[model samples]
Target: MRTSIVFLSALATSVMGANSTTYTLPAGFNVGLVDSSERSAWCSAQRNTCPDICQDGTRLNSCDSNTLDFSCVCADGSTPDVTPFKQTVPFFVCQANYGQCINSHPDDAEGQRTCKKNAVCGSKNATEEADSSSSSTTTAASTTLAMATSTDSTASQTSSVAAASATTSNPAVALGGDMTKYSTGFMAGLMFVAARMIL
Candidate 1:
């Protein structure tokens, strides 16, 4: 019984850890907790396409039209002083489902403008950029150290460092834009397997 309890505890910890990725709001946006009525109105203004609009891997809640819970929205309905622009602009809207900014351009060919995942809207300071660079470098150094001890390990570490550098340079991979669905499915499968083993 004790052994089973320990195994179940470890399994639960792993399951939770697998799904623990938190979404960070990109720069130039401030999130506000809005009531359901405001969220509904905002979603309606988008023709009830919140799910499609907020699919940029930043949504903290489910993309349902009828949900009554408080959801993230743009603070005061606009992101002011975005980078390269000195004035308050009204063309951007907070995705009703997520708090990220959507650049709604009427003149665009598609009639809608969607920013990339983890995109920075406003100006990023030099400090922030430097920190991000240093963090990536530190991560690569640590990974290389842990993977290398001898000549064979050096080869593997070199490849690993190359892969890490590539991922860091690529915006999509660094932000995990394409891994959300796969990670969710993987977590579900893990849970199922854990349940079977526990039973």
Candidate 2:
């Protein structure tokens, strides 16, 4: 009985060692000429680590094998749709069912006008005209100049501008002009002639 037990132990060890050999699989794991589609999965307790599964070319795909097969996992961003196609021509699904209305020319549309009722929509040619118009409008709407508690910056700015304009308009201050300096020189030359005549 001890001899038979030792023989069985050696036989089991030899079988395990033989199954440990490296397996070389073909491309896409296909073993051709053998109908893998018809072959039933030889599942066992040891098949918990089975390498491959056979797939079908039908609506229902191949089955997966795990240690304890629980539930199927749906693919990413995909749920099983009962209505795969609207009418088999494939219309858009989950579309927005509301109408949208937006005025392309928003500035002139929706009860708004480009310009006021009588005013023309145009551009000003001159900056001075625009400034004068704006200033006149402000002056017409007020009765008195508002008293300034702060320093008068605009007054100083106007004075500087007046001084610049006066300098440019009166460029012949010390050099004299045709009216005053020329007349004074003529009077002096006439006096010199008179003095020479007296001598």
| Highest lDDT model number | 1
* Estimated TM-score for each candidate: 0.18, 0.15
Error of 1 at 142 (Å): 54
Q: Compared with the true structure, what per-residue lDDT tens digits does model 2 show for residues 118-199?
A: 2222232223444576688788665344434123667877777776655533533534533354667765665565455434
Give all candidates' CA lDDT scores.
0.42, 0.32
The root-mean-square deviation over C-alpha atoms between each candidate and the true structure, in angstroms, is: 29.3, 32.4
Could you give candidate 1's per-residue lDDT for residues 112-170 as a string of tens digits?
Answer: 33444433333334334445777899999988877665667778788877766554445
lDDT for 61 in candidate 2 is 19
lDDT of 1: 0.42
Q: After superposition, which runs of candidate 1 have C-alpha atoms over 4 Å from their true positions?
A: 1-13, 20-22, 36-199
